[model samples]
Target: MNTVPGFRVISLPRNTTVRVHRRSATIVLTLVVLALFVLMLTVATGAYEITGNDLVATFLGGGSDMDQFIVLRQRLPRAVADLLVGAALGLSGAIFQSISRNPLGSPDVVGFATGSASGGLIVILLVGASSVASIAVGTIAGGFATALFVYLLSSGGGKVSERLILTGIAVGAMLASVNDYLITRATLDDAETAKAWQFGSLNIISWPHVIPLAVLLAVLVPLTLTMSGPMRVLEMGDDSAHALGVEVGKTRVWLLCAGVALAAAAVATSGPIGFLAMAAPQLARKVSRSPGISLLPSMAMGALLLGAGDPLAARALSPFQIPVGLVTAALGGLYLLWILTWRKG
Candidate 1:
């Protein structure tokens, strides 16, 4: 019934009110538009170019056979995978940062991404499982196991945020070594396959890869969004959140599970693409100028970052292609330097 300067409040049937920040909404919309533009560019600018008209026509089932095959059968799946995986990483990063109350509280920074990779490697190299379903299972199992280990290790200390970060980093380092050992122990062919996967590429993506991820995100994204308010309340501290009727321990556990699942899904799909998880939430926060993490904005920013990065990875070297993960890692390193310098300044 009332409107504020920077937010719009809507009255609900049960005497409840929802306040939406105007600027955050604007920024989310802008990011979404940019993501769409990047998607179009990605589909249009490959070895066989598809003009704007042809791209639209292909989508509408009206393009020539060659155009349709290029757009529908080839590029669209990769673009969709980039978008979906980026969203997963972004949402996962936002959840972790919120839980740890640290900018660096990301799965990639912690141990979960490495754990997922370790799981996939064990299946691929040791058990010799080659199916996508099997790899996804391994990654999820590895991620959950790592999360449990980190939480148990960190539970003793009252400062969970600090302990979680430190434990995760240490665990991640060990897991990286294990992954390397696994690769080396395997046959040359298996090692080569694992190495390429570890670097993370969208080149091998297709509808089969995209469908399962899309379905999982369809369930997880909405579920995560519903917990956004409770997550923010938890950030206020245990005593305060308890006073506000939030079950601190239970909420934290559920949140961590969701976060780990999201990160694992991205890894299962794209082999631990780095920095997108760590950077998307922080970038979204800065752009929206919001004090707390906003899930929608983070997801939008993640999609936009990967969407933009995919084209560059494919076209930056003309004939030669770089894995999307390497590009993100390079950019993420630069982002870290800027953040450190900006803080000191």
Candidate 2:
């Protein structure tokens, strides 16, 4: 056995056990490779019936014009969007849960998802906002507003507690009610449009959404990676972090904002697509055997969950495609049940 600077290595006759950090990195790397394979699979298999050779050839710049148009123009963009959305939500969820030091302390728990949905609904139902740009703005504003509300109520303790959880649930329920009321006010056509978007389909995804999402991830990716070190320190408790020269209050706020940015961006693109933020971190922790909330593992899991689910959703009903959100929601429900029962037992 040998010890490295940041981690320990254990070598045995049959196998080896590396420390948590290295193990987590290995898990993430595996997930990334799997995600790439899945991306190619998704691009190749779709309703549009492109032969494998043609699809691969198109990817390599040799397919016919129609195959090129279908694969390049349509399939590739949605696949990229799914990956970005998953990574963003996964990273954001990991940060929030790690800082909150509670499994329940995710952006979804704090009402950011509902807040974003409320924002989009308000833009659509109130302002008759149909353009993508307008919806994106409203969704982000709503997320920020929700975070502000949750923070104001939950900040006294300097840590996430049951009160924060309860308050967030209350606020989320209220926002959901607001969404219902807004839907009531919408015209039938607008309501249909809003309903469809709310369910979260990749059909709305194209160049416009994909470009901004790429840029958003490019910025937040580095910021979240930088924050992970301090976040680990923060997990020890407020007094401990402060003693270690980490500004507890400022760090908490910045982490919350950063988490909200990632969550809000995902919500904007996918209409509060559920489950990834809530489940990915737990799944990552379990799989990587990490001592704490490993952000890289969570991001990789989120990307894999959502990215792979997209094609499954497409094929679930054969000729008719189901929204990927529903698939994740169903999976999340099962996960929640298992955790609850397991914990109780």
TM-score of each: 0.95, 0.92
lDDT of 1 by residue, 148-200 (tens): 99899988637787899999999999999999999888899999999989998
TM-score of 2: 0.92
| Worst-scoring 10-residue span by lDDT in model 2 | 11-20
lDDT of 2: 0.83
Kindly report which residue stretches of model 1 are placed more than 4 angstroms away from their true locations once superposed: 1-5, 12-16
lDDT of each prediction vs. the true structure?
A: 0.89, 0.83
Identify the leading candidate in terms of TM-score.
1
Per-residue C-alpha lDDT of model 2 across residues 164-279, encoded as one tens digit per residue: 66778889989988998888888999999888888878875887888887898888888877777678988898788889999888887888888888898888888878877978
Q: Model 2: how far is 56 from its true place, Å?
A: 3.2
Error of 1 at 88 (Å): 0.7
Error at 333, model 1, angstroms: 2.3
Off by over 4 Å in 2: 1-20, 341-345
